[model samples]
Target: MSEALRRDYRVCEEIGRGRFGVVHRCYSPESGESFAVKSIDKRLISEDSVDRQCLYNEVKVMNLLTPNPNVVQIFNVYEDDIQLHIVLELCNASDLFERVTNRVFSESEAVAVMLPLMEAIAHCHSHGVAHRDIKPDNILFDEWNRLKLADFGSAECFREGELMSGVVGTPYYVAPEVVAGSEYCEKVDVWSAGVILYIMLAGIPPFYGDSATEIFEAVLRANLRFPPRVFHSVSPVAKDLLRKMLCKDVSRRFTAEQVLRHPWMTSGGETGSVAVLT
Candidate 1:
């Protein structure tokens, strides 16, 4: 298998490392196209059984959503006794976290970046997959500056009317129900996306604390505020959508599909040709 990979492509420098594997830059000698190869050591998987399951689950979800412009594209999978290799579309421009860290995005810019993401998450939900984690780091941009949602390690499929109770996700971006260990639906991803949008526009998270405990408490209370310093210039429609997305009541929160059609999203006139799912 190693010989096959070496023969077909030139595997290059490491680009990313996660709990499941290390991602490396690889180029196909024939096509001259670049791709990412995630190498997960079988030994590491043996040590933590769940890690292997997560790796396979990520692959399953990525494969299920293939050809979607807003989701990372997985090309092939190579496996042997040593490790499992999954080839993915390389986003040379990097993830949204880096972009957000470098500069504050205006409301228009935030909407442009988020519209596709909203569609991607909606598509995932429509297919019964829930991306338990939806933060800036999981959102990536390709060479064309097109946004793609990545990292499906925490994703799970739910039947109709199913509820998820796992306590997962980053503290600051987690939904109130998730923080309280209550069963949650795919809308939890909407809450997290709302947090990302808040950070993108406001230049900081809506919820914060000195420690995880305090952050969790704040999340449970779900007291959201858009202070004037950040939101002063933001349009009222944008704030209204933000409020809907961040609503503490799951029933009131906007689903990803609904968010894409919100007046603010449609009225911005900044949304590109994103393939929004119904």
Candidate 2:
């Protein structure tokens, strides 16, 4: 085998698969560091323009992230003529989807997770990185329940001291400015983080519909709702904070730091909210 093809990866088992490629648990014999190997099929890209550049961007961006406590770390990159390989640190704990699919996050559970979630997002913003995609799948918990933000494929950099423009992010979580074709910036990331917080507390996303248009419409025109069941034990201050974070207007949403200061964020009670990213 070629030296590159002869890597000492254990190739444990398949953990994820998407249109672009497959992800597997792998480990290095020399370092003994666990890694998630994402192999993208070159066939997935027809033209070598923006798509290919994006593939490369994922590599470059991961390299640039500060070694913050919450951000996923990229360890190596490899490619054959037919496939691009990205190997990243494996966050072995369950993700938000797993938590939700299984149902329930006790108040203490929510608080413990949110603290790290906010810290990570704050760190990303401080580093000039925007996690354009925020949803349950992206959030993960290690055995210690430590939160780590995963997946930077959709992350983008804003111009220095400049906000962002155009639409980017999951449909339900996209901020109003992004959805309305107005200029947006890092605050959009805060909006997604809020959505994540809501999910952790409440167990479901605030916006949902029969179709994408309907869901987007709900996000754009509807008020985010919280139920009494969710609020039964949650404090008024926490609900008030949720009201602020999930606000429809991008300008109106609470910043990650601001949300971090919310009483509930510290107290750790939640009823419902948006999904986590993978």
Candidate 3:
């Protein structure tokens, strides 16, 4: 543990660790409240400026998030000569991947995830932020199974109506415009969300292969199977929603707002409110 750790909070145990550093489960002694502290060892620099820029961008985006139920609250940020710390709400529940392993989600439950997810994405879009990486790992569930979008490490901010040009994000969830070497906008994030929603309903991704190259080819071709065996009870309406969401052209795909009102999503939904301004 760093000597700079807040003495106000008792560092409990290591809850998570990865390339960045370690995340400690911490508890506030005064209020008996628990939170996760994300520690990034900045001293161990990556190979290029891109990695440093990406880390700094993540910090900037997290700092800009507004108070919203579906968004993870970044409580504090502090750093030392060797590490940068991010304190966040600690929800020790399972992720979408874990849920999918046990039970297939009903259309109602899928809608529950979709409504908040769409609203959160819209909030990001409205604030000129693009969460370039959207996937099951980045979505967290609280005690009530409510959804929260986490990890803005791959986010980019664009000027009014301007699109960014660069290949970013995970291969399986990347948008066509991004894959095709063309400039793309917020719709790219929508594409990734569609893939996530599709996985939630169907219990697997639309495109898959043994290697990254094959998966990229499938996404580029929009190759997929209808009525996948795992999705036996899913309705045609849900399938149609997925098709529209995964459209190759970002322009033709559903906007975050349009996705909120879609039949399969709104027919069984609860409205949510979220803001993304600093």
Highest TM-score scorer: 1
lDDT per residue for candidate 3 within 28-146, as digits (tens), equals 88899889888888867664768778877887887787667887888777777788888888877997667766566767788877888888898888888889988878888877777
Q: lDDT score, residue 8, model 3? A: 60
Worst 10 residues of 1 by lDDT: 269-278
Candidate 2 ranges beyond 4 A from true positions? 267-278
Model 3 local distance difference test score:
0.80
Q: Each model's RMSD to truth, in Å? A: 4.4, 5.0, 5.9
TM-score of each: 0.93, 0.87, 0.90
lDDT of 1 by residue, 163-196 (tens): 9887889998889998888898999999999999
Against the hidden true structure, what lDDT does model 1 obtain? 0.86
Q: Which wins on TM-score, candidate 1 or candidate 2?
A: 1
Model 2 poorest ten-residue lDDT run:
269-278
lDDT of each: 0.86, 0.74, 0.80
| Shift of residue 140 alpha carbon in model 2, Å | 1.9
Which order, best to worst by TM-score?
Answer: 1, 3, 2
Give the Cα-based TM-score of candidate 1 against the true structure: 0.93
